[model samples]
Target: MSTATLNVRTGPGLSYPVLTQVHRNQTFSIVESKKDWYRISTDKGEGWVADWLVTRESTGSLNETGQQGTVSTNGLRLRKGPGTSEPVVTILNKGDIVSISETSGSWLSVQSGNAGGWVHKDYIDLGAHSSASASPSKNKEAKQGVITAGTLNVRKSPSLNSPVAGAVHRGNPVSITGSVTGWYEIQFGKSKAWISDNYVELSSTPVEVPATSSEFTGKITVNSLNVRSEPSLNGNIAGKVSKGEKYPILSERNNWFEIKLKSGKSGWIAGWFVQKTVAGEQKKSTSSTQPAGEKVTILHNGTNIRSSADVQSNVVKRADSGETFSVTGKQGNWYEIKLKDGSTAYVAGWIVSIRTGSGSESSPSRNTSGGIRNKVITIDPGHGGRDSGTIGTRGTLEKLLTMKTAQLLADKLKSAGAEVIITRKNDEYVSLPSRVSLSHYYDSDAFISIHFDSIYDSSVAGHTTYYYRNYQKDLAYDVHESLADRLPSRDRGVRTGDYHVIRENKQAAILLELGFLSNPAEEANVTSHHYQDLAATAIYHGLNDYFSN
Candidate 1:
């Protein structure tokens, strides 16, 4: 599971384009690992994310720790805390030896020569030391299994980095003797075989019960899902449930859940598609209720609908591509939809397109409930960590000022009922394309990038709002007008910008240049807490107007 709003890139490095952005608590299975990155396999496809940004869920029963590293850079400071502002305990020069004890994001707790503190992990070169060095314990209970994987690699040790001992194909028989951290210790030809638990299915696979009582429930996060007869993908589909449907989880088997269906029969669902919830706890699910006068359009062809109260029928609805029919009534999972011929037929509600009848081209309807309430917005504080951005004449950092302003705005936005996703939560350099990818990943209603401008010419000074597309012009105008009315700086006016954050964005994205950091006087004014509050408040007011009006 990711601990922050992290980018899953095409490759392990920042140079690669971002494939998608995964937020906090979203888990994906790791297929491979290289250096400080993990190759994650999702239903969408495979991508890579920095290991520091995520916490791995070990389905296995053991955890291995302790790695060795050497300092890669000279004058790397060992700080009292994980941040740059923390006091320096001691500075270590090039080739300094250290032990990595803990990790907090990009920072690693290092100990060198009787002195221990936190240092950035980028400066430490970790060696190829194997994890779980000790051999896994032998399985006392003899077991048999069939290799589910097409070609499963038998490793010399439990670690993925271990040398390949042999290979086993599908339909091959295996004798299991022991296990460790999700790896099976099997008996191989004259040697012990260590295989990943994910590849093989034992006759009596070890069942790990996640919960026993009805205290744990699950909420369907996907638009539609199939409830099955058993806990595996091969199980027959017993029923279908739309997003936000809740069910009491009866038990767990191999990560799948046995849920008590509404009809009282227990059915299995994929655990990954459902968000676990406490039974008595209330969660504010995403908007699913239909707005008045809005009709429903079929999302897929040959979708099922109820022909009678007891039976379902597959019927085709005739309409133009993007056309919607009036919804006369809702019956269970079916909607009574009026056809092009003026005759009404019941259509499956889960397979219908969700679009507003107003047919908006200027902006996406985040929620008809109004304002910024429940709207997902992305707020990006530009240039951080290694990217210090522009430096003011008096030593003021543009990154620091932008972070301050963004945080204030984030606090206000959260208070006003907005679900905000911060591109960089701290002093971390986020790639420009990844920031844009985050907006699209979350389906953001609006994306705002906060920045401070600078140049060789200190005389130039002002605040400006920039939009890349015609659809973003309205948002730009609203925010710029508000900032101009409130700040002492000159109004640079809203204009079309060619910046990466907005130019590559598909959502309503805008960049705000709060003030010219190169101008000593302007920098002094904008960096003040009072000025930041005013700027943040103005932007908040502008967003409110844009959403409510």
Candidate 2:
């Protein structure tokens, strides 16, 4: 199949019901063709699939010495050698034909038009003219294993001294043909390759279990708990939850609890740090309504109290860390509280841990001195190394400007008692995914990506803050307002952008475009040390405002 998993329908049309799903690298026999769909014979039964979703194998005969094959996957890399470690020569799109010159374990040396390179055999379909029969091989009776490592290296030989031929990511299914010492021989592509046994889990059969709702209610007990993408610790960090945050348990695997996110996605958290609340206890806690005007302490710093119970309502003020307030009432996921001036407000219940108390003191003043203490923030300096980003008329590089600004901002955040992480400390190229991954891995409270804009029109010299999701919109506006007020440029205002780093980031992320590089005056101002300091100070204050309110 062309896709990772495609739904097989009972009929070729869109109105048909789905019979089953087929995974990538799986093969099926085509029995009939419709206007834009194909009826295939699968192990389950006959099913119809959209023609665009599958790559039909060619029935043309192949020569004994040199066979013809077609690329079966989109963006298939053709490398200089028969291994993933080799440099990529070109990329072949699906349906592109090539001449197979030779084959090495799981990899095929092929010439596509004038370009020749090695491609993984799994992404190619040899024509029927090949001498090899369509029937299963005698060695098909083998064990199955799933790669558990983030990236397991495949070596040319079983020894560690051998060159790395390829790599497989976590959750990849591999057929284990043989075992040698601490290595497992697997059918990688067109040939067999050896992978370290330590990273592969041998299984009798593949298992696909859907996440289901459970009766468990999980509460985080630690100061902060890391949520991951998979059940294993080696899995990438996805997000984090504070000590008092609660989530509904969706499933459990080993020592991890699969929990549902506010976005409706699933994430895994360490089970050891999560305490299961008994159903009876939960019921008892919510059974009796508390008296109006009861007091509750806000455990977290910078908790925003809105005019209404909804998050989108106007923010009345922010409660400082350890501040106390009177609970007027309760709304869905919100606590209605009485402000210092006897005004009513609402704060998110999840962000603040509440404890029963008597109304004694007025709301404390916002802690401006060190509200960010112990908070984690990630800074990403855009475009480095060979990527110079935008160049100004005076030859000022965007990469250098971003780095200088980011370093200054990091210093300011650190001085404010916040823990700061710079995605790139030097002039090294950091991929967008890596930048986002670093933020998640650190469980940062906020992520900022710095960059300078360049356009054909030099007149567009201003600062703009971009955010992707609704949760990040407040942060974007907070930071942008500070910069707009302090900077010596026009305000481009806050906007929704589709930038990769911010779009894919799990934390509150915002991308700041300081100024336009194409404008000489703006470039000169942004490239100066004084302006960099001002920018950094503005961002520092912006973070304070963000957290405080």
In the order shown, what is each candidate's alpha-carbon RMSD?
Answer: 21.7, 21.0
Report the lDDT of model 1 for residue 164. 50
Error of 1 at 500 (Å): 0.6
lDDT of 2 by residue, 1-549 (tens): 545889999998766899999999888877766656889998889999987567766543311235666788877877878789996655577777666756767888776543567898899987652442221111333777656555676765554434444566554566787764346787655467777665665555542212224445677868887889998767899998889777877777765789998888889997766665322223312213344346666655566678875434687886776787767655433567778888888775544545454534432222432466678999999999988899986788899899989987876565345789999998989888999999999998999999999987554568899999999998998888889867756888999999999999989999999988876556766886656766776787788789988
lDDT per model vs. reference: 0.69, 0.71
TM-score of each: 0.34, 0.35
lDDT for each residue of candidate 1 in 166-214, tens digit (9 for 90 to 100): 4665434567877754478876544586777655545443321122357
Runs of candidate 2 exceeding 4 Å displacement: 1-366
In model 1, which range of ten residues has the least summed lDDT? 360-369
Which residue pairs collide in model 2, if any? Answer: 61-129, 62-129, 105-191, 106-189, 106-190, 106-191
